[model samples]
Target: MEYILGAVGLLLGAVIMYFVGAGQRKKILEGQSQQDQSYKLEAEKVVSDAKLNAEKIIAEAKLTAEKTFSEFKDKQEEFKQEKIRESREKFQRFKDEFKQEKEDELVELKAKREALKEEQAAMKEERASFKADRDEILKLQEAVKIQEQQLEQRNKKLTEEIERARQKQEELEHQHERFTSELEKIASLSQEEARVRLMEDVRGKTENEAMALKREILEAAKEDAAKDARKVVINTIQRMCSEMTIENTVSVFPLDNDNVKGQIIGREGRNIRAIEAATGAELVVDDTPETIVISSFDPIRREIARLSLKRLVTDGRIHPARVEEVVAKTKKELTQQIMEIGKKTVVELDIHNLPSDLVRYVGRMRFRSSYGQNLLKHSIETAHLCATMAAEMGMNKNQIKLAKRAGLLHDIGKVAEEDSELSHALYGMALCEKLGENPIVVNAVGAHHDEIEMNNLISCIVQACDAISGARPGARREILDGYINRIKELEEIAKKNQGVSSAFAMQAGRELRVIVEADKVSDQHADELSFKISQEIQETMQYPGQIKVMVIRETRAVAYAR
Candidate 1:
């Protein structure tokens, strides 16, 4: 029984140990299973996340493709719109060009049609004129035939009248011879001697009467002609003497400061000497208060010097080299100024198509002055006067232009000393001739000063223009002393004349009035005294305009007041 109990305890111990060990193994197995489950769950979770990520990536690719397709479509639409706009713009440009071309074509066609119409109209007028001429010739022929018939009838009547006159004359001669023979027998003296004395006495009386009638007719005609001539002269003078003022050439330049005068006369006078040499001018630095005079015989040189000096003073740079440079520049400027003045003159005068050289010559006259009169101004005035007279005379406009041009150029030789070898008139003529001026102009220029004989109307006009310019009142002046001496000489000449009680010189010495005793001078003697005074005045005086000599004959009978 003890052995059996021990065996049972051992068996129980082995069983308890086995069960505890098994339980421990089971817990370990369970932990292993839980770990495997957790790993499986984690593996499943990773596969699910991978599937989700792949789906997301595919979805994102699809969306990207759709977006790309949409963008491409938009791009295509935009490109199409741009192409359409380009086409429209191109179409508009083409349409405008076409419209303009059509308009131009239409205008050309219209002009051509108008020209054709004008041609047709001119042709019709010409045809009508030819027809009129034919009709006029026929009318003239008919009139001529009628005139011829009338002339034949008149000639027949003249022959019949002449025959009758011849028959009557023959009968008269026979009767006269018979009467003469009867008278001779009755008379105491011979017929031939009696007739001679009677004829001689009648001839002497008739001759005296005829001589008186001849003298009276001649005197009346002379008086009428003299009166008409005087009227014409007065009328011409009055018409030509318009108000004219002579213009002088005087240029003035202003200075900046007095100190500039020293700079102008630079270190040791080098600047002034250079300027003088370059411009050929005399610089007069006087006490005129900020002014200097540039004096030169050549007006152009003086103008250049004046301008150069002004520029130097203003720039405040004075040296020999600078002076030379400024002078050259001033010369160029003056040349341009001269040319501009010339061009302006031509334009003002309405003179076109002048030769280039001729225009230059005309400009040179700006620097020339004659007796205080600006040459250019005088030329312009002469041109205007000539043109006015020509218009009044109804002359050809081109001919008038030639005359005016010749008048303006009459003193052109004075501008060029080298060309002044000939007289002014001759040189002017040669210049015109070289320039191929109108023959009338060439001839007029040569003959203006009577260097050549006056051969054309233009020449006479030039001479008249010169006289008008020089002889008008205030047009010219002589020295005051010279004028006084001339007046004194005239007074002395008149005082020396005999039978003159008082003598008065008037009309600027153009007329002399002599008062003589009435008892000493008869009507015939007065005429003789006037003639003598006129002859003496002509021989002694050298003056323009004709001098009039009047011998006054006055016989006053005074009554005494009681």
Candidate 2:
């Protein structure tokens, strides 16, 4: 009974173990199925995504190809249109060229026809001249024969008259000799003595009459000359005014601060050296508060230096390269400035018709000064003065314009390059002529200072204006030292001449009074000496207005205190 109970218990245990393993295996199978479903869903998702991507790539490729094709079509159309336009333009150009060529040919033909007509007319005139010359020659020959016959008859008649006169003269000679002998006897003197006495009487009467006549002529001539001179001078003076401005050779440049002086002087003074060499002026960098001096004998160069230095200091980029660049640029700017100034001056002067190059020269005059007078301003003033005087003098409108234009350009040559041998007047005239200025204007420019003869009324007007402008007091200022030296030179020149014992330049150097040694210089010789001194002064000295030379030779007999 114990063995049967053990077997039943084992069998029950085995059945329990089997039921639990079956439950676990069923659970494992459900888990495997769940994993399979998950993998299947993942694979479906990957394949759908790949198919959708393939469709997208293919669609994109088609779109790209279509766009490229459309663009290419558009380009092809553009090329076709451009070619058509070019062909049309070429055809039009060729047609226009052909038409122009036809017109030119027609014009040439017409010119040639007219020239032929003129040539024919000239030939006909020449033929008529030859025929007329032949007829004149024949008439001259016949007239010569008639004149020869008349001359022969006159010669024969003159010979007969001469023979009769010779016979009559012989008879009269005998009677005169007898009468002269009788007169000599009555006068108790020889014929020569009596004739000399008669001559003395006649000479005295003639001397008195000649003295009276000389006085009358002198008074009349002086009266007329004074009237004419007074009229012309009064007319010019009343109508004109000239203003002069003087500029110095050195220019002062203002600085912002003292520190910039280093930049201007630069390393080893290269900047300053470059500036000096470029502008032909010396730059004075000194220990002042805030100023630099540009010194040069040439005002234009000094001006350029001052301007360039100002710009460089303002820019604060001072170096050799910067200095050179600024100077060059400033020079161009200054040139342009001069051109503008010249143009405006011309306009203000109411003058016109100047050569373009001459106009540029007029602009150059702004920087040129003569005797402390600004040349450009002087020129403008001269133009106005000339115009006024011309109008007052009853010149025509065209003449007045010419006179004014000439006055404006009269001193253009003063701005010519230094060391040029030509005088300003001649040089300006040459420049005007080269530029095709009016001949009358050229004459006026050259002849205004009497360097050449006055060719027209306008030239005379220019002369009058130039004189009035320069001769005005205070128009020119000579340095005091130079003026004093000039006065000394005048005295020296006068004293240097022979027979001039003492000389004094009186009337502010307008007149020279010379005391000549009476024993050495005669009254007649004193007049000659005065002329010589005047000529010497003219040749060697430069002065305004007239200089009179008076030479006195006094002869005094000492009979005092007897």
Candidate 3:
């Protein structure tokens, strides 16, 4: 019975196990079936999506094709239009070429017709010329026949004249032989000796007559040449108007106030000392109101000092350093100013082609003086005088220009910076030669002072003009100090004589008057004194004109009634 119950329980347990397994398997199968259905549904959806995508792709391809076709049509139309335009252009060019060819043919035909007409006219002229030439030939043949007849007549006349001339020549020879023998016997000499004596007499007479004629001619020429020379000089002087003033070494610097003098002097005169050392000039502050005198032998120095002082006074900065700076700057400016003055002078004088260095020297002449005359003014006057004289002497334009140029540059050496031992004339000549001046101009510059021999007419003109300019009245003046000293010396010279009691200088030192004591000097002695005094004046002193020495010795009975 336990076994039966155990078996039943096992079967029940087994049945229950089997049922549970079946249920699990049934659930798995259902789950598998659901997955299969889901897969099928997903597949169907994929296929539908693919069809839709295919339709969309077809639609896009159609659109692309239609667009391509439309573009092809557009391109085709453009190509056709281009081809048509090209064909039309070709046709027009062909028509134009044909027309041009026709026009050229017509022009050629017209030219041919004109040429034919000209040829016909030339042919007619040639026919007329041939006829005229034939007539001329006939006339020439007739003239040749007439000439042949005249030549035959001349030949006959010439034969008869030859016979007569031969007989005459024979007779003349016989006569000459007889005359020679008779001349020898009458003169008691050989034929050759007699001929020589006659020749000598004729030669002596001719020589004497020629010398007298030559002397007369020379005398006449001297008178005429003197008259012409005076006329030329007088004309040149009349044409010129020049300044008459003395150029002094001292330049007056005008100031706005007297107070500016103190500033220029500076503290302890350091400013002035600096100015002097820098410019090589002296600043003289004297009692003269509103004027400072800048004194220097070099006008350039005085000008620099003046300008430097002007700048210092204007800027109100007066010190040693500032003074030097201003003076240096002023010197540069003055140098540049000198160059400008030179250029202006050359331009105004119409002088050309001068070197820059030489031009600078010309400007320096403005600050130079010769015998109390401004060198530049003197040069200008001399230039004008030279030009005028050259013109008067019948010189051409080129020679006149040369004369003027030479005159202007004649005194260039006086302003030279070098301290040369040579005279200004020679130095000027060397400078001109060094600078490539014309030979004539160089000679004129050297010979103006008569230091060198003149080589040409222009050189003589320059010298003459220079003298005329300098020797003109009121053209130059003696310095006041010099004049006073000269006057005192003139009086002293007369007083130093033994017979003279008192002496006086008269006529601007042109004459000297000596009064002698009557008791000490007789009339004869007075005459001797005068001669001795005149000799002494001539020997000891250099003067412009003759100085008249008059010695007075008169007896005076003088009683003063009081």
**How well does each candidate superpose onto the true structure, as a TM-score?**
0.44, 0.44, 0.43
Between prediction 1 and prediction 3, which has the larger TM-score?
Answer: 1
Report the C-alpha lDDT of model 3 over 330-420, residue by residue, as the tens digit. Answer: 8898899999999999999898898999889989999888877899999999999999999999999999999999999898889878789
Error of 2 at 267 (Å): 0.3
Which regions of candidate 2 deviate over 4 angstroms? 1-248, 254-259, 286-291, 417-419, 478-546, 550-562
Which pairs clash inside model 1?
Answer: none
Candidate 2 residue-wise lDDT, 332-363, digit = tens: 99888877887888788766776567777888
What lDDT is reached at residue 3 by model 2? 37
TM-score of 2: 0.44
- lDDT of model 3 at position 96: 100
C-alpha RMSD for every candidate: 27.1, 24.6, 34.0
Candidate 1 segments whose C-alpha is farther than 4 A from its true place? 1-257, 286-289, 417-419, 477-562
Clash list (residue pairs), candidate 2: none
